[model samples]
Each structure stands twice: as C-alpha cells, then as structure tokens.
Target chain A: AQTVTQSQPEMSVQEAETVTLSCTYDTSESDYYLFWYKQPPSRQMILVIRQEAYKQQNATENRFSVNFQKAAKSFSLKISDSQLGDAAMYFCAYRRGGGGSNYKLTFGKGTLLTVNP
Target chain B: DTAVSQTPKYLVTQMGNDKSIKCEQNLGHDTMYWYKQDSKKFLKIMFSYNNKELIINETVPNRFSPKSPDKAHLNLHINSLELGDSAVYFCASSQGDRVRGTQYFGPGTRLLVL
Candidate 1:
C-alpha cells in the first residue's frame, strides 16, 4: 500500500511571501501521480497542482508549484506570492498510474496553512 | 454550472438513525467515488463506482452502502449511524479515461450523529 506523509501539522506565511509544505510518500511503483489539494474553511477540496513521477521537471500552476523528487520519494508544494486566499488545509495525495483500483488516491493527514497579512 | 453537486450540505441526526446523501455530476463522467473525512481531518476513500458498477470497496463498515442508479449519480446510504460516523462526506467524480483524470469534488455533506 502507498502512503503519503505531511510532517508539518501547521504552517504560517506572511502575505506576498513564499511557503513550502513538505510531503513524502512511500511507493514501490515507478510511475505514479502526486497531487496537492487545498481545503478552505468552506471545506471545498480544490486541486492546487499535480506532478507526474516520470517527469523530471516540476509542475507549476500560477503561483503554485511542486518540488517532485522521485528519488527521495518527496513531493512538496510551494506557494509563491502567497495571498489570504491561500489559507487552507493542504493535502498530499498519491495515485498509481493505470486504471481500475490503481487510480484510487492515497492521501496524507494534511497540513493547515495560515496566511498572515 | 456546477460540475458536481451533493445534497443536504448539513445533516444532523441521532444515533441509530438512517440517512442518505445524494451526489450528481453533470460532467458526463463515468466514475464516481465516496470519501470520508474524519474529525481529525483525515480523508480516506470509502467506495468507488464506475459506469454504475462497483469498482472499489475499501475497508468501510457494512453499515455504509453506496448505490449508483446511473453513471452520473452516486448516493450513499448509512444505516444505524453511530457517533463515530460523524464527519464530512465528500462525493467526487472523474473522467473514465486512462490518463490524468483529475477527480472533481462536491461541496461535501457534513454529517453530525448525536
């Protein structure tokens, strides 16, 4: 079974600054997908960004980017130019490549991020 | 238009009561799933259905049952609910393609079993 771990329980960052949320996973499969989901106080799960294990280049979406290190089994999310809207609970998820049950996502506990003005 | 939606955003019921939460997706996706977020904020997959067929059934309790009348709708029925069942339930759907199919989630149903 694959497991994702977010060591930081809580994190805070000043407005316009950058914040990095650490994530590490355990997977024996060579090909997989890693994702970052943001859950605001509204409790809506929104996709922040995603990274494919086969790709060496990190994935970036606007101000959100990921540091995907397949060798270290680490996939961290970096939020640049952080804004108040960035305050939320961030989760790291892992999904094996392929169809059927392999598509099921294995999620981490979560990291609550606070953006300070 | 809402891609995915869930009814009864807030559900407050007593223990031993039965409740049902409905989920629908207008995205024409062939796959739907049910996930449970515990009080500790841990989310886990409970059930998954594809094309009205049960595909993945996690280690969830038998008290919880998932019904998919069609590919666009997946409803969860919980019988004899317990306090431990109090948590936020999320309904999500994704394209059935073999590639990077991202799952889109609903607003979530907050269930409180008192």
Candidate 2:
C-alpha cells in the first residue's frame, strides 16, 4: 500500500510571484512515477507535469517544475510567474512504474492554491 | 476536441436508485479508469480496465459495477445509491500503464444522491 501526503492545506501567492507546493509519498518499490494535477473551478483535472523516479533531473513545463528527491521521497511543484489563472486545487499523485497492481494512480488530498492578483 | 469525455456532467438521483455514467476517450488509449472525488476533494480509485479486461478493482462495493464495452470506453453503473455515493466522478485514459506515459482526464461528472 502507498500513501501520498500534502502538508499544505491552503496556500496563497501574489500575482507574478513564485510558489512551491510540497508533496511526499511512501512506496517500497524502486521504480515509480510522480505527478502534479490541477483542478480549476470548471472541475476539470489537468496535468501539470510528470517526473520519472529514475530521472534525477527535475521535470519542467512552462512555469511548472519539480524538485524530485528520490531519497527523501519529496516531489515539490514550483510555479513561477504565477498568475490569477493558477488559482486552483493542486494534487500530488504516485503510481507504480512496472506492470501489475501498481498501474493504478493514487492521489493525495489536494492543496488549495489561491493566487491573489 | 476533448480527448476524454464523460456523459451526464451532473447527475441527481434518489436513494436506492440505480444510475450509470458513461466515459469515452478518442486518444486511442488502451487503458481507462474511474476515480471518485469526495466533498473534501480527496480523489480515490474505484475501478480500472485495460484493453476491456478488468484490472484494478479497489475496495469498491459490489453495488458499483464498471463495464467496458471496448478498449476506448468504460461505463460505471451504481445500484442502491446512498447519500455517501454523492461525489464527482472523473474518467481518465492513458496510452498504457507505463511510467513515462501520462493519463489524460475528462471533465468530471458530479453525482448528487439525495
């Protein structure tokens, strides 16, 4: 069994600033995947970025990048030049890399990010 | 075009009633899943199907049935609904269960059981 934890229940960032959401997970498997998902008022889940456990280099997409620390089991999402549109609920998820029961995606209780413009 | 879509974006039903939610993906992905989001915004897995074969069936109750007509579609049918069954259901698809591949999500269907 694997569990993901998001320490921040709520976070606020000023417009044009930077914000980082923290996430950690517990898994015995060596191979896995970490992800950040965003849900806006429309209730649509959008992929922010994904990081492979084997890849030490963090994943970056536009304003979103992650500090993936395999040892500490920490995967934090950083949003730079934050805008009002970035206000949403963010979730950290984990999944097994190999085939079998680990194929399913597990999510953490979301962190509410409020971007004040 | 929406890559993954779910029908009946909003569902309102009475207790003990039976209802079904349909999901379809045009991404040509071979794997699909059904996830439930509670009032607290906690997303949990309900079921998953790969290539039309049942794979991950969480601790979901027997009343909640998932049917996959083909590889591209997975439908969720719930029987004897309770107020606790009220939540937002999301449909997602992935090329495969590979680590590098990402799962695309659909606009969730909000179910309100009264």
Q: Write the per-residue lDDT of candidate 2 for residues A1-117, one digit (tens) a residue.
A: 899999999999999999999999999999899999999999999999999998889999999999999999999999999999999999999988886633778899989999997
Strongest candidate by DockQ:
2
> Can you give the lDDT of residue B26 in candidate 1?
99
Candidate 1 per-residue C-alpha lDDT over A30-70 given as tens digits, one digit per residue, 9 for 90 to 100: 87889999999999999999888888999999999999888
Per-candidate RMSD, Å: 0.9, 1.0
Chain B only, TM-score of each candidate:
0.97, 0.97
The weakest ten consecutive residues by lDDT in model 1 chain B span B94-103
What's the residue-level lDDT of A98 in candidate 1? 65
Off by over 4 Å in 2: none
lDDT (0 to 1) per candidate: 0.93, 0.93
- Candidate 1 yields a Cα-based lDDT of 0.93
Per-prediction DockQ comes to: 0.68, 0.71
